[model samples]
Target: MVNVFITGASGFVGSHLTPILLAAGHKITAIARSESAAQKLEDQGITTIRATLEDIDVLAKAAGEADAVIHLGFIHDSRSYAESVEADLAVITAFGTALKGSNKTLITTSAIPVAGVPTPTELSPGKIPPRAASEQLTLSFSSPEHSIRSHVVRLPPTVHGDTDRGFLAHYIGQSRKAGFAGYIGEGENHWPATHVKDAVQVYKLVLENASGSLKGGEVLHASQEAGITLKTIASAVAKRLGIPTKSITKEEAGQTYTFLALFLGIDCVASSELTRRWLGWESVEKGVIEDLEGSGWYFEETSVTKF
Candidate 1:
């Protein structure tokens, strides 16, 4: 069994992922920042380490002891996004130092938006986004000189499932607050998506094959649906809220969606063809629109919590 060290083990994707790893006989050492989170992990028979991202020494020590490390923790604050990115880079650096020349596996999470391409593939070379530095650093550990087996899994904007309090949930909340769902002009800009279940499996698969099939520094895309139009997503929210869907100007989207305005208008389509070919992974969950319309969970709550 693999002795895995994981950050963000109590989070949305991590919560789903831990169960699968446990079922597969893997031992998990998870980082928990709160008593409640620690209790939750302990209840599930996981070893908990109380620490935050800034604890580089503690993170490095944990990485040294584990057979592999999966970093899923990220700060999502928009106001201090640069600081969040800096923290992520520092955390990855600690892991790299601990595992350097050991040939151990290290998997770091990234996003498709950072690819800066119409349809980003595994080999895309642009680092236009702020979070790109972390991605670049994670992959650098895989070079022959460093001797660390590293991989980057780029997630889509919408990792949707029940109990999801992400971007889509925020959009739903905005629709409720405004009494009408709003989208940018024509809403032609697309947002890539994947069900949480499908997304988690990619990590599991990467862990399972890290030593055997995976080459170091590979970038995997977990996006099942390359892109879905914002108009379509807004319409789904509108139908659920029983409100009209309105097309708004980019200037007006800022006032309507608040922090979500910029994301609502970005086109971040991505393809997983290479990832599928390399890992033989397939996404079997329902698509975003289908899940939104059929789940009944997204609209059941009167209040949506922003994540």
Candidate 2:
């Protein structure tokens, strides 16, 4: 079994990934910033490292010795996005140095929103993702000859399924609280989607198939469907919450959602043919349809919710 050292093992993706890797008979050493999270990793039969992004020494040591390192610990404080991004860069740079000569695998998470194409394909490499600058930096490690097989998996906006209480839940909850399910203008801007289980498979496959071209590194999109229209999503939420789905004017969308309004307004349809062709990945998990039905958040937290 290959020994894999992973960061953010306590995160949504990491939580699912650790068990999957363990089931695949891989030995794991998970990084956790808290005792509770560390204990959780230990309970899963994986070794634990009581360290965080700031602990450069510990992280360097861990990356140097492990067979591979899958980084997932990203600071998500919206209030401190820039600071968190800079810190992430520091951590990645440290790991890149740690695994410089070992030719080990370093798989990190990125998103497909960097480019504005309504539908992005593997053929579109220079697609500049305004939201995902970190991806560009990580994949830059690729060169004519680099020992490290660094790769990026651009996850969907909604990495949904039964366990998702993230964006979709928040939006639906907000909608119910507002008394109407709302989507930005005409609600035609599309968001790509992938099941959490399906996304996890890409992680395993990249680690399993670490080799030459991967050494130059690659960008993989964990997108199941190219696009799911905002109108459809609004309908789903409306139906689930028993509210009227309505389209807000562009002006209102901006006033209500602020920074998120632009993203929610973008029409993106991303293709993951490369990810599938390369890894033979098949997202066999429940799609957004079941995800909306299962969360039951629409019914549970209705009274206090605000759109």
Candidate 3:
């Protein structure tokens, strides 16, 4: 059984990931920021370390001791997105410092939005999204000279399932408030997606297969649906909430979607073809729209028209 250290043990992906690793007979040392979270993990027979992303020393030590380190922790403060990106860079650096020459695995989380399509002009440093920048930096630690097996899983903007209370939930809430489910433009812009179960399966596969066989600096996309249309998503929300779906202009979208306007207006489409070829990850679970329309829990939350 490999000894693994993981961050974000209490999050959406981590919550599901911990059990699968345990069932596979691996011991886990989870990093937590709160006593309640630590106790909860300890009760599950997993050891806990109290630390935050800011605790570089603790993170380095934790990464050094474990056979593998999976970093799933991220702060999504929209107002401080730049700061969050810097924090991610710092965390990766600290982990690299600790695991240097150990040839251990470092699995960090990234998103497809930041992994935009290749451009001809070459992406300027300032033009690159913080998440994408962090991903590249993590992969840089994978060379023979570095001696660290660094892997990055680029997730879809929407990682959905039965209990998803993330972006979709927020969108549903906004739809109810607006009295109509809205999509920007003709709603042709697409968002990539993956079921939480499928995502968990990929993580397990990566951890299991990422020894000497799977090379370091590999960037994998955890995308199931390459392009789930915005119209389709808006329709799902509308049908469930007994509301109408409408296309809103860019100017109108900013007013209605608020902080989510930028995302709502983006195409942000991605694929997992490479990931499937490399890791043999096939997503057989339900699609995003199907899950959203069928999930009773999802509708229950959106049923609340008031804040």
Candidate 4:
């Protein structure tokens, strides 16, 4: 069994990923920020490191001893951009310093929206360069820089599934709260997606492939369905909540969802052909629009309480 180290193991993705690796006979060394969270990790037979991802010295020491490192911690607050940058940079530097000369595996999550051209063509590959520049910065250290094995897995906008706490959940919560479901403009903008379990399996595959080497600084997209449009999601949300559905102006969307407004507007159809072809990653995720329309979680949360 390989010994793997993971950052942010108490989060949505990290929580789901833990059992998968453990069941596969891999031992996990996970980071937990709280005492209760650390106890939970221990209960599950995981080695717990009680430190945030930004604690470079602690993280580096932990990472230096592991066979692979999965970076899943991120600060979603855009208001603290500089602080977030500082933290993320520190973690990256720690990883480099800890595994500087080693060819160990390191995987970090990224996204597809902010990487490349607004409308990417078939000719324009989606290796990287989307919403987050962190991919380039992280993978830049591969071989040439620090000789550490590293890669970025760019996730689709909607990581739809039962346990998701991200975009889809927010959409459902707000739609029910507002007594309507809708989108901006023509609602032609696409939201890429993959199931949580499917994405986790992809990470496991990357971990096992020691011979493949992920080519220092590699960026792979975890897109399962590339073109689930926003309008479709709105209609689904409306049906589940028994609410009216329609389109709105961009100004309206901006007002309703201040932080997510810009994100909901980006349309990019990402392809994971490279991951499938190279790493043999196969997606078993149910289609995003189809599943969201049917999930009980949407209707379960009352409009009175915010998500």
> How many steric clashes between backbone atoms does each model show?
0, 5, 0, 8
Per-residue lDDT for 1-307 in model 1, tens only? 9999999999888998999999999999999999999999999999999998789999999999999999999876554778888889999999999999999999999988888888788888547667898889999999998999899999998999987888888888878888899998898889999999999999999999943678798999999999999999988888878999999988888898887897888887888998888888899999999998897678876646555
RMSD of 3: 3.3
Clash pairs (backbone) in predicted model 2: 114-128, 114-129, 118-269, 119-269, 174-307
Among residues 3 or more apart in sequence or in different chains, the pairs in candidate 4 whose N, CA or C atoms overlap within 3 Å are 114-130, 114-131, 115-129, 115-130, 115-131, 116-129, 116-130, 139-217
User: Candidate 3 on 44-75: residue-level lDDT in tens?
Assistant: 88999998888999989988999999999886
Q: In model 1, how many backbone clashes occur?
A: 0
On lDDT, who's better, 2 or 3? 3
Order candidates by lDDT, high to low: 1, 3, 2, 4
Worst 10 residues of 4 by lDDT: 122-131
Residue 97's lDDT within candidate 1 is: 93
Q: Where does model 4 exceed 4 Å of error?
A: 77-79, 118-131, 210-213, 302-307
With candidate 3 superimposed using the best TM-score fit, by how many Å does residue 290's alpha carbon deviate from the native?
1.3
The candidate with the higher TM-score, 1 or 2, is: 1
Top candidate by TM-score: 1
Candidate 2 deviant stretches above 4 angstroms: 126-132, 210-215, 297-299, 302-307
